[model samples]
Target chain A: MEKKIRVLVAKPGLDGHDRGAKIVARALRDAGMEVIYTGLHQTAEMVVETAIQEDVDVVGLSLLSGAHMTLFVDVARLIKKKGLDDVLIIGGGIIPEEDISKLHKEGIAGVFGPGTPCEDIIKFIKENVKR
Target chain B: MKDIAKKVLSGDSRAIARLITLAENNDPSANDSMKDIHPHTGKAHVIGITGVMGSGKSTLIYELTRLYRKQGKTVGIIAIDPTSPFSGGALLGDRVRMMELTMDEGVFIRSMGTRGMLGGLASAVYDVVEILDASGKDVVIVETVGVGQAEVDIIKIADTTLVIIVPGLGDSIQTLKAGVMEIADIYVVNKADRAGVEQTVAEVESLVDITCSEKERKTPILSTIAKHGEGVKELIIEIENHEKYLKKTKEFETKRRLRYEAELIEIIRKRLMNFIFDEEQFKDKVELLIDQISKKQIDPHSAAEEILSKILK
Candidate 1:
């Protein structure tokens, strides 16, 4: 059987609210991907480490605590540092429009903010995933 | 390439992870890699933890992993969840319980969806176990999705099988009568802090006594409040004892042989299915036969024989 798109939906930093993360994780799952959810309060290194062990094609970092800039870049850089160039890094949550551009510059493949449809995220992943 | 297999044999986490994916996909290159990995395996002890949903199996696994880490043994965890049949998706939430170990270099956790495989394990789990073993993990744990009756495939994979139960679950023994309890090498009464711990333990002990009273090796029943780490030390001791018993009796070799036989059969079945179905002409022939059968023009048995004859030819 063909390998299903494997995704790690990680909640980074001290934020405890995981409703958004869980919702997106479910959406990705319903879209036919295998989602490994690292529940609340994860560090950047933990996220990267999990992504490596999971061999996921995409790392979906969901943050609502406004630390998306640091946490997102930290995960992205760590993935790169580990020579995981093929893993696509995407971010979602309350990330502001301005930070999306910064995150994009920092190697984030895409960003989905509040109200972005899950299908769009799923489409983005299917199209851009290195596989 | 040989380099991927070499890296995995040398305990490179990246290569280990990547090779698992390749094996899951049934890529031919992974078969070559497995040839290299097979020799380096058989070192780590493989354990299977299974129970009903909400039985705290994940929490127990987290505690067990921590204990092994304290003993200076590297650990690998394969947490399996069921795939949604309708959507072909799965929410593997076991990682939540073991998140504390995520940063520990000595611990590697991989969550897998069953991918619609049968018997409560992912089809790729055999390879994953070998990959982790070859990667130098001292212990590899396979956690099955909260399974109901008859998910005993874990028995084929684990050297030690821990069947987890919890208190206050209403006639826990009656629930265990469903054939799921027979596969336990060790019974763990988790959530022992809850009411009726003694009752549950007694029930399991009586069952074990009744079932194995004549056997030389009796199944030990242990209790644990996995949430607070209470009784986990005793549980670990019991597990290690079981490991020693398996070695002493040479049952470890028997279990490994069973695991390999199951894996070999699964691989051959999958390859045969892919080979027969991948040919466009064969697929079209099957489709035509299905159409005729639906229209009652051809019997299903005849269609099957026709296809069989082609393959035989």
Candidate 2:
């Protein structure tokens, strides 16, 4: 059997906006990947623990609470600190333009802002997933 | 691979996670480590929780695990969801309900897709159960994908199977039906605080009385609002009681023996399928036989015989 791409779609911080995260989860499932959704209000430690326990090929963080710089980076650094280097990291939600590069430098391989197509995120995972 | 089992025995989280993935993917290398871990299994009490969708199975498991943790029992949870037939993928959102336990060092939660297997479980669930058992979880909880009458496969793997039901889905007649209703060692009426709770409990109670007349012990029916952690401690006690009953009746050893028989058959079945269809040596010959059968020159049984003959030879 071919290895299925496994991704974790997590909403970090105090974000109750899970519509975007659920949409991405559904889109990833439609794209033939196993997506574990941790739902809203997850701390970075929770997300990293989920990623580790899941042994996912990718981690997708969706934060619409405008706490991207602090929250997304916290998740990225925590995931990295846990040595999940092979797991691809991506982001989505209502982030402004400037922080995209900052997120990348923090180890987020892709960031899809509002109105960004789920297809692009799916494709990006298929392309950049290290495992 | 032996080292992997060693690490797993020490509860190395990463190694345990990787071994589960390898088992899920059906990689050949996992077999050796599985063999190494075999003796360490059969220590954990395997609990199977099943229900219809949105019946609070996940929340019930969360509450159960919390209670178990309060007693210092380590838990390993495998939550199964269906894989999309068309897309061959799945959304394993059971973790959402289990987020609170994610950071707990004693709790290990893994979600799995059914991967085309039916019976409310993933094909690799049997392996994952053994892996977790060997990893030192005192309680191994398996939450099946929400199921109907026929997904009673949980009985085969679980030492104690709880069939969860909510109010308002159906009435007394639902419990009278066969397959699922008869398989529950315990019937949990979750969301018990909802309206119609009394009727649902009465329905299940009457069914248990009627059906268990021929049995040694009557199946217990309990009510709970899993969302609020109501009645969970009582539920856990009932579970442990069931385990003790099995042991007292010497049914525990008998049940384990029966379970191993089923496991052995399944392993043989899977190996035979892979050998006949996937082995490179017989690949072309099997295809030719299939072509012949499709053209009505041969029957499927005879083709199977031909393959088995080659295997046996």
Candidate 3:
């Protein structure tokens, strides 16, 4: 059987609101991918460990906590340290357009802010996930 | 089974950690590894611990894990936290409470975010539990992010579910009544050194008495100062007793059967949905339907029907 793409949707930092994360998780699941949602208040280490343990093809981070600059970079660095550069790292949240360049430079494949469609995120992942 | 699976079963921590990461990422190699290790599963006792935020659930799990380790048993801990909705990043801070066990050879701890799942438990948790079981861990403890409805999801995945409560959290019983109280196989009054321990214990007892049937076993409420590791041994005994009860009543087999059934259905649903949506021809149709729905030209129900009919035809 062809394996399903596994995506770990993580909420990093102190942000407690998860309505958007849940929506994206369901959307990814509906799109025929296995989504492992790490509930609220996750650290970079926990996210990296989960990504490793779940062996997900992609790690989608939803950080509305405005700690995106620090949290996202930490996660990206950890993934590389763990030899998971092959795992596509994508993010969404209240990220400002100015930060997108820096995030991309940090090895994040894509960044979706508020109002980005779930389909767009899914499409981006589908195209990028290494089969 | 991949070579990593064999190494993990043999208690190679590095391999186990690497394989867990692979599984978390849903790496294709993970499936091969799991297949190799599947036969070695079913030995570990799976226990799930959950409660509301600030309830000291992590402290309780940390305490409980120590007791298990004292007996020379290997343990696997899965700590589930919440993911941010907007940024999709996670902090996973629960490991802080478990720092003491970091160097313990008998303990392997992995913290998982709820990712985007509303429930405290992640979908891959079941698979991870199985992986830990196959790795020869005598016990696997899953700690959930302490939210209300999401905590209930823990019950479905755990053989023994412990709901931890702290005192001074106004009407803790009332909050429990919302969902978690009913699913708890064992209740822990954690942070017992704090005020309101007696009140919390009394409330739980009364609730248990009112809700538990005469034929159903009484739910034992234990008090623990998890931070100081007090009363942990008694909690372990209670857990073992629950295990024994399940075994003696033949409930163990029934629970396993139900778990397998749920898993099978979930897999089928996922596969069918993927097959329907991933079809190349359906892609453009889906995109067009989404666009129409977004434009308010058509309702979602009708669009879904159109898609289904095309598949049916």
Candidate 4:
């Protein structure tokens, strides 16, 4: 059976805005991937544990809260510590191009910023997820 | 299943954590692990705590977990958060609020991202809950992202659901109108000392009065200042009372049955969808349908019908 790619979409930090997160969740659902939207104000530990528990193929972090550097890195580190390097870790929201390279270095597979289409994310996961 | 289940039952943290990951990821080995662990579950009391952002839910859980540890009980917490859509990255900052409990030998805290699942919980949460139960945790806490309607999903999985509401927010009561109020087994008016505590309590009481019947148990509304650890013991007592009520009324069995039924349906639906998508001929047909739909040659309804007919054959 061709399993549906399960994605865990999380908003870390104190960022309350979730319009983008919800839209991405809907888009992924539309694309036939099972998506779990962890609501606002999560921590790195919470996101990693969710990714682990949900058995998701991808962990997508949406951080509009400028605290992306610390939160994203922490999540990536935790995932690694837990030996979940196989789970694709991606980020979206307000991340600067300069920070993108740094985040990728920190184990984030991809970074999608403002104006990136949902299809792009769906396609990226389809290509990158290691089954 | 045998080896892993034995390790989990013996309180092997690594095995427990690894199994939880496998289960969450829907790994092929997870079903076997679950089957081995299923009978060992049902001993742990599952509690779900949820509220709006900044309600100090983590601090409360931390304190409560400490209390449980003092009594020599193992605790597992699942904190759910939302994921960023554009970046495909997450912040997962809830664990910071729970840092104190992480290193505690008696406490196991796992943070989960909402990962686009609307119900403030992952589908694997029920499985995780069972794993924790089987792992000898006397109590398990599932903390939701607390974003109003989505938090209601906790009701389906929790043995006791606590809705934490803090005072001083001008429209906090009004915000708790829909899915939030209906699903609460007990409401904790946390941050009670901050201000407007009486008003918040009164508002919740009135709402509860309107929603609950006289024959049904009234959802006890407790006041707590979670930051200062005030009124926590009382809140715990209320939770215990709710649990006792559930067991006495046989509601626990009914709820578990419903959860199992839902789980069964969800698994079947997922498997069937996978089977459909896996068929090579069906994939080609779907591609053709997509092309036709893209070119406006056929409507989605017709495409769906065509696919269904092919599946039926």
* Deviation (Å) of B307 in candidate 2: 4.0
lDDT of 2 at B248: 92
lDDT winner between 3 and 4, please give it: 3
Q: Which stretches of candidate 4 lie over 4 Å from their true place?
A: A1-131, B168-176, B277-284, B287-291, B294-296
Ranking by TM-score: 1, 2, 3, 4
Single out the weakest 10-residue window by summed lDDT for candidate 1 chain B. Answer: B169-178
TM-score of each: 0.95, 0.95, 0.70, 0.70
Order the numbered candidates by DockQ, best leading. 1, 2, 3, 4
How well is each residue in B16-78 modelled by candidate 4, as lDDT tens digits? Answer: 866777765566787888899899989888998888888888889988987778878889888
Flag regions of model 3 displaced more than 4 Å: A1-131, B172-178, B272-281, B311-313
lDDT for residue A38 in candidate 2, whole number 0-100: 84
Chain B TM-score for the candidates in order: 0.94, 0.94, 0.91, 0.90
Per-residue lDDT over A73-104 for candidate 4, one digit per residue giving the tens place of the 0 to 100 score? 99999999988867999999999889999999
List CA RMSD, all candidates. Answer: 1.8, 1.9, 8.5, 7.7
| Better candidate by lDDT, 2 or 4 | 2
Return the clash pairs for model 2, or none: none
User: Candidate 1 at residue A96, lDDT?
Assistant: 76
- TM-score, candidate 2, chain B alone: 0.94
User: What fraction of native interface contacts does model 3 preserve?
Assistant: 0.05
DockQ of each: 0.84, 0.81, 0.07, 0.07
* Model 4 TM-score on a 0 to 1 scale: 0.70
TM-score for candidate 2, please give it. 0.95
- Name the Cα RMSD for model 4: 7.7
Query: Across residues A1-131, which tens digit of lDDT does each residue of candidate 1 receive?
Result: 57789999998899888998888899999999999998888888899899989999999998888988888999998888988989999998887777878899899999998999888999999999997
